[model samples]
Target chain A: MDFALEVNKLCKAYKDTAFKLQNVSFNIPKGSIVGFVGKNGAGKSTTINAVLNILHKDSGEVAFFGKAMTDDAKYIRNDIGVVFDTVHFSGELTPKKLERVMKDIYENWDGALFLAYLERFHIPADKKIKTFSRGMTMKLSISSALSHKAKLLILDEATAGLDPVVREEILDLLLEFVENEENSILMSSHISSDLEKVADYIIFIDNGKIILSEKKDTLIYEYGIARMKQSDFDTLDKSEYLSARKRGLQLEVLIENKKQFTRAHPDIVTDNATIDEILPMLTKEESK
Target chain B: MKGLIRNDFYNVEGSMKLTMLAFIIIMIVLGIAGIYFPPNSYLASAVIGGTLGAFGALSGTAMQKDGASKWSRFELTMPISRSDVMKARYISFILYILIGLVMAIISALYFMR
Candidate 1:
């Protein structure tokens, strides 16, 4: 596969905390949007930080378009755009002044496009960023990220606090960005619905490890939640389901293949699984 | 590196202007005092030295602002190397020093006359 970004066995450890990223690895294929879903402190931000070299990794290889980050960072970084959960620019800077700062840093910065984006988002060019609300700050960050002719965009919870209307607009912009087939996005967001709207693949991380990585369509269409009695659960093999939970006399099981499960057990009912439903099922411990 | 230096300059520009304005006012007051009272001419030199010291601290303030705003982390995502970042900062510091020196020299010459 032609990948825009590749992470191999990435590891990082914090001195102050027991938290560590253990053998973390993922890939962002060209022309695709990958959703990174995990609860708080699940190493989503840590992985993104390591990938961008913001936080140094203890060991691993991060490559951008087949070029190693350590060896070709100066050249490769120009092709990547990153937006954190919070806006990183100085509060004193207006969008207009920020353009000047960015144009100098990015070789391919488009000042006209940046101004147009601000206008499109209804952001005043001359107003200081500190005065703007959280949503406006987020829009500014997205505008800056897009203005740079980047091939790969890494966004960490970029849509968390925005209203649905603005979130939809940002999702549409992301959809437009990847239309070229050469561009890709790795967005880590808590909002699974946003990911469901735009993601091609979903990678679920838990406790600093990737628990599940699969195609969004496959996850939604093939995965199923089965509610079965204790007698029926005991009759089934452990391999049949991914995880199981018990409520009263009934057992809720997460099955990997909805069609296959239904075919095998005609008497049991299996409902389609969404990312939201699957996340809790997969992350929580199975009832003994 | 040029871009990084420009950013540092922008970050400190407002405070730098205010500092320079105060620096000029102090130099002017010292210059006038030195002319009327030659015995206190040494005070002008002290003020000039003090102003330069403040300029040095102003350079550090830019870095402090960056750290406070978490801009340093964001800066790493750019193409610039770590060495380049430090070099840009030192260059900004040197520029601030040069500006202070020039103003001091002008004030010194004017007071000497």
Candidate 2:
């Protein structure tokens, strides 16, 4: 499979903080949207930054479009668009003025497409950016990112601080962007519901370590959460469960192979696990 | 590199405008004073110094805004190279200095005569 992005053994550490990204590796398939799910301070941003070379990695490899990202091959960045939570634009300049500045910067800037996005997003081209609301600012950032005719988009919490309606609109835009098989997106979000709606694959990270990376359908459909009596759980094979949590007289087990588990233990009941549930369940320390 | 330069200039556009206005006002006042006061050479230096100070302040303001907005985080993610980012900043800084130098030279020549 052709991958738009490939990361292997990525590691980063800060002097003042205990946080460290340990051996992070993942692949973003070409023409697919990969959702990066993690809690606050869970190293999602750190991993993304390392991949972009924003934070120099201690050790690891990151490749874009099959080319190793080295200081010599910096031109690969032209094909990638990026949107962050708090985007910095000149507050005094309007989107129109910003266009003039960006037009000089990007070789393939699509002025017509940018203006169309501004009109579609209802962004006033003449007003100072400071006057725009958070939603408008986000839209402006996305518009600029898209206007560059980038092949891949790297968004870090881009949906953050937007209302449901605005988020829905942005999600739709993302869907539209990937309609061409050449385009792809790697977005990080704490909002599992948004990922559930748009992502083809999901990668979950916790405490600077990747907990899981799987197809969205497999995680949603195959993974099962079983709640049962502790006495009955004692008889089940320990290897059958990925992780189990005990609550009062009952216990919840994360069955990796639900079909196999059910076939072996027909009396035990199993329920489907959502990404949100799977996140905490997998991240939570195993309690014996 | 051109994009980074444009971004930096765009970010500092308001400050640059204010700095230009201040320089113009100072030059006009100094020019009027030079006519009446027998072209005091110190006055020209003072005007140039004041304008340079204003430019410095404006640069500070722009830097503060950039820092506050966490722009480096966003900027590094773009297709531009890190060397290009550093080069853009240096070039912009040089541009600011060049603008100040021109104003000072023009003021000195005007007042010296």
All models, RMSD in angstroms: 1.9, 2.1
TM-score of each: 0.94, 0.93
Predicted structure with the largest DockQ when compared to the true one: 1
Query: Per-residue lDDT for B112 in model 1?
Result: 68
Q: Model 1: what is its DockQ?
A: 0.59
Docking class of 1: medium
lDDT of 2 at B61: 66
Quick one: best TM-score, which candidate?
1
Fnat across every predicted model, in order = 0.54, 0.57
Per-residue C-alpha lDDT of model 2 across residues B30-55, encoded as one tens digit per residue: 67776777766566677778767766
Query: What digit string (tens of lDDT, one per residue) describes model 1 on residues B1-113?
Result: 78888788878888889988897787667667666777346766786687788788878889887887678888888877788788898899999999878877876777667
